[model samples]
Target: MELYGQVLLIAMPIFLVAVLAEMWYGRWRGKDTYRTMDMISSMSSGVTNVTKDVLGLSISLLTYTWMVDHLAVFDIKATIWTYLIAFFVLDFQGYWVHRIAHQINFFWNKHAIHHSSEDFNLACALRQSISSFVNLFTFFLLPAAVLGVPAQVISIVAPLHLFAQFWYHTQHIDRMGFLEKILVTPSHHRVHHAINPEYLDRNHSQIFIFWDKLFGTFQEELRDVPPVYGITRPSNTWNPVKINFQHLWLLAKDAWRTQNTRDKFRIWFMPTGWRPADVADTYPVEKIDDLYGYVKYESKSSGALKVWSWIQFGITLLFLMYFFGHLGTIKVPGIFLYGGFIFLTVYAYTELMDHNPNALGWEILKNAFGSYLLFSTGDWFGLNHYFPQGLYLIAGYFVLSTLVTAWFVRKGITPDNFVTQATKSQSYSTLNTH
Candidate 1:
């Protein structure tokens, strides 16, 4: 956990720099791929994913260490060849894991957040799953176990393998000449992320492009066909927490609604986006049918609302940095408390971005609870040691943010306002014509 925190301390800034650089580069080329609310939601999704990981909130169905201890066949020595073998084994395992997530209805919920963004940018790369508590991919590591790869070796390489995937999520890089055949380049990954009919489920490789090629899932980026990013069913909201479980909730509802006993039992393992026949007819969910008619999910936000959302995201990020630095000192329960605060902060601000009126009330309640917690605790998990006056600044921030949020809410600061303005203008013009 400490190691993860340390690595994240370095990684978080690098990710920010890369995303910002991509945004700037896109504008330079006269195209803006970064939407403010979409980017915020993407970054918030990353925060939840990392928080879940750093808190060690996962259950293992089978232990890799146990498998390595018992299934040793080769007793391979720890050398460069073993590391290469391990890397290939890991990538192979990753490909299947990625494939199943898209193929199965139940498992797709955990992965849907990654493809939920309409715009493909580096920030969207951070849209990882927070609902992934079960570690059921142990069977994929059997090749490594048979070869007698040590658990220590896996622990070292796993983070590197995951981090290796982050760079390819960008739209900036084009086709690489030689590396195109070897590694998973940006073009290859873009095909994977696209929802266009041709690119729907192609290119499931993580680090290597060969896995997709060998498995018959490879589709090269063609000049004639452009990739349209995002899933068929738009989530229509900016909350990552909600996006994580939206599909699962649909499955649960279908299981309850369907009269057929067998259908209820089998719905989870059915193909992706399948619903019980009766339930599908009675409670029809609208899916995007026409490519030309598709509208990206967006809310009307005044410039003030946009600036307010950024301020909230920036504040939550600073608090996250503080939590990571003091991770060792904060007790387990305190870790959860602090993490919960950060999560709620994300939920509140994101709800505001969605232009949900209820968001103001949620934010006000969250701040009230936060203020009381600090007043009673008198410290932010040992942060008082660094700066005695910091708590005052934090308290003032909570109070002031709540007030600012309330003001925005009272101003009718959603896209709905634009519609209202249009109606009033039309009415005045009609009166003048009469």
Candidate 2:
């Protein structure tokens, strides 16, 4: 956990810089693809995912060590050749795992956050999954395990392989001539992210473009059928935690509502987005039909609110960095507590971003929890050791956050009213990237 957290301390900043650079490049090119709230939502999703990972809040059905121990036919040494082979096998493993997430009904919940953004950008690339509690696809590395690749080698290659995919998530880059055929370029990824009928589930490879080609899921970007991003059903709210489980919640409700036991049993593994026939007719979920004409999700945000949201996001990020940097010092339960606080910070601010009236309530709850931690632990998870007055400042921030949230709530601030006011004051136009 400490090792991963330390690595993230270096990686996260580079990612943020890349996202900011992409935003700047887009504006300069007159093709801005990022919305403020959307970017925050995406970043918040990333925070929750990383926090979950850093805290080791997952269970793998079969570990790589276990696989290699029993399945190896030949022992391989950790050389340059070993890493190259590991990278190749990891790419193949990523392809099938990614394809499964798109194909199966139950697994789609683990991946839906990635496709939730209507606008594609580097920030949206950060929208990974927190709902994937079980690592069910470890056996996909059978080839590597059989070749006696060390578990340490797989562990090292896995994160590097994941980070390598981050750059191609941008809309700023066009097709990369010959590289498009060899690697998953920005063009290939755009198709993978698009919800248009033509591009629904094509291009499932991570690094190698050949996997999709070999598997018959490859669809080239066409001139006429422009890519339309996001899922068929819009996740209207700005809360990433809520978005992570929205599909699973629907599935649970459907299972309970269905009369046939068989339907309940079959719904989970049937196919992605498949609902029982009776449930579909009785309780239909909203899905996009006119791909070009459907409205994108938006919430009313004044300049001040946007500024406050950024502050909240920035502070939450700082808290995460502190936790990551001090993992070994903070110890077990302390680290878990800090992780919980991080989750609450994200949930509270994102609720405000969604303009939910209950946001104030969540803020109060967050402040209350933070206060308890401060009083009971005698510091903000050992932050006082770094700065003498750090705890006091955190206390002040909590008090200020609660007050601001209450003021917003009492002023009748909601998506309905605030958006109207924002529109009359300033015209915010969606860029025509197509």
Candidate 3:
């Protein structure tokens, strides 16, 4: 956990910088693919996911170490062949796991968060899952286990593999001549994230492009079919935690509503968007079926609301970093307490972003809880030990945040959708690189 925290401390800044740079580049080129609240929602999702992973909030059905211990046929040294073979096996494992996640109703919830955003950008890449409490993909690494691969090799390679997927989740990058054919480029990933019928469930490979080619799921970004990104049934909310379990909740409701017991058991294993027959006819759900009629999920937001959202995002991020840096020093139940606080912070601000009228109340409660926790714990994760005025600074932030939120509520500040506003002002050509 400490090592992961350290990794976050180092990598978070770099990721933020990259997102900012991409934003600048897009603005300069006149494509501007990011919406402010959407970006905040995405980053908030990242925080929740990392906190879940850092706190070790997941269970594995079959341990990888056990697989390697019992299934090995030959002991292989860490040679070029070993590393090369490991990469291939991991890629293969990633492909199948990703395919399954998109194909099954029960598993889609674990991955739906990644497709929740309408706009595509580096910031949207941070939309990750936190409610996925099981690591069922470990069973896919059987080839590595059969080859006597060390758990250490798999551990080192796993993160590198995951991080490599981040860069390709952008609109700033155009097609690379030869690399497009060999790697999962930004163009390919845009298709993977699209809701367009031609692009749905296509290109499931992680690093190498051949997995999709071999498995028959690859689809090139065609000139005629410009991809419209996001899920068919929009989440329509900014809270990542809510978005994470939205699909599962729907499935659960369907399971209960169905008359047949067989339908209840079979609904989970059915195709990704499958619904029970009676429920489908009686309680029809809205679903997007055409790319030409795409309308993004959005809420009204004024300039002040956007600015306040950014401030809250910055505060939440700073406290998250503090929690990461001091993970070891904090004693029992402290880490869990920190995690709860982070979740509340994300939930409150996102509710505000979603334009919920009760958002002010949640924000007030969050600040009240924060103040009580600080007064009781005596510091912000032990910050008062080094900085004498740490408590005062945090107290000041809470006071200031509450005041700003209250001011917005009192002023009756109504907001307009950023994406709709931008689309009315700018035109994106289909022939353009983006």
**TM-score (C-alpha) between model 2 and the true structure:** 0.96
- Backbone clash numbers for all candidates listed: 1, 0, 1
The residue-by-residue lDDT of candidate 1 on 1-434, one tens digit each, is: 87889899899999999988888987797666777878989999999888888888897899899899899787777888888888889999999999999999999999999999877888999999998899899879999998899888888788889888989887667789999999999899888887778889999999999998998999998765667778888898889999999999999999999999999989999989999999999999968776434666767667888898888988989989888888999968888888888878888888888877778888987798678768878977887899888889989999898898888778775545532211111221121110
Cα lDDT of model 3 by residue, 1-434, tens digit: 88889999998898999998998888898778877888889999999999899999998999889999999998887877887788889999999999999999999999999999887889888899997888988989999999998887887778778888899988778789999889999999988998878889999999999889988999999876777778988887889989999999999999999998999999999999999999888888878875555456666678878998998999899999989999999856899888888888888888778776567888888899889889996877789788979999999988888788777766663444232322232222342245
Per-model CA lDDT versus the true structure: 0.84, 0.89, 0.85
Q: Write the per-residue lDDT of candidate 2 for residues 105-180, one digit (tens) a residue.
A: 8999989999999888899989999998889999999999999999899999999999999999886777798998
Please list the Cα RMSD from the true structure of every candidate, rounded to 1 decimal place. Answer: 6.1, 2.3, 2.4
Off by over 4 Å in 2: 415-434
- lDDT score, candidate 2, position 325: 93
TM-score per prediction, in order, is: 0.94, 0.96, 0.94
CA displacement after TM-score superposition, residue 32 of candidate 1 (Å): 1.9
The model with the greatest TM-score is: 2
Query: Which residue ranges in model 3 land beyond 4 Å of their true spot?
Result: 79-81, 413-433
Q: Model 1: which residue pairs collide?
A: 300-415
Clash pairs detected, candidate 3: 301-415
- Candidate 2: give the clashing pairs: none
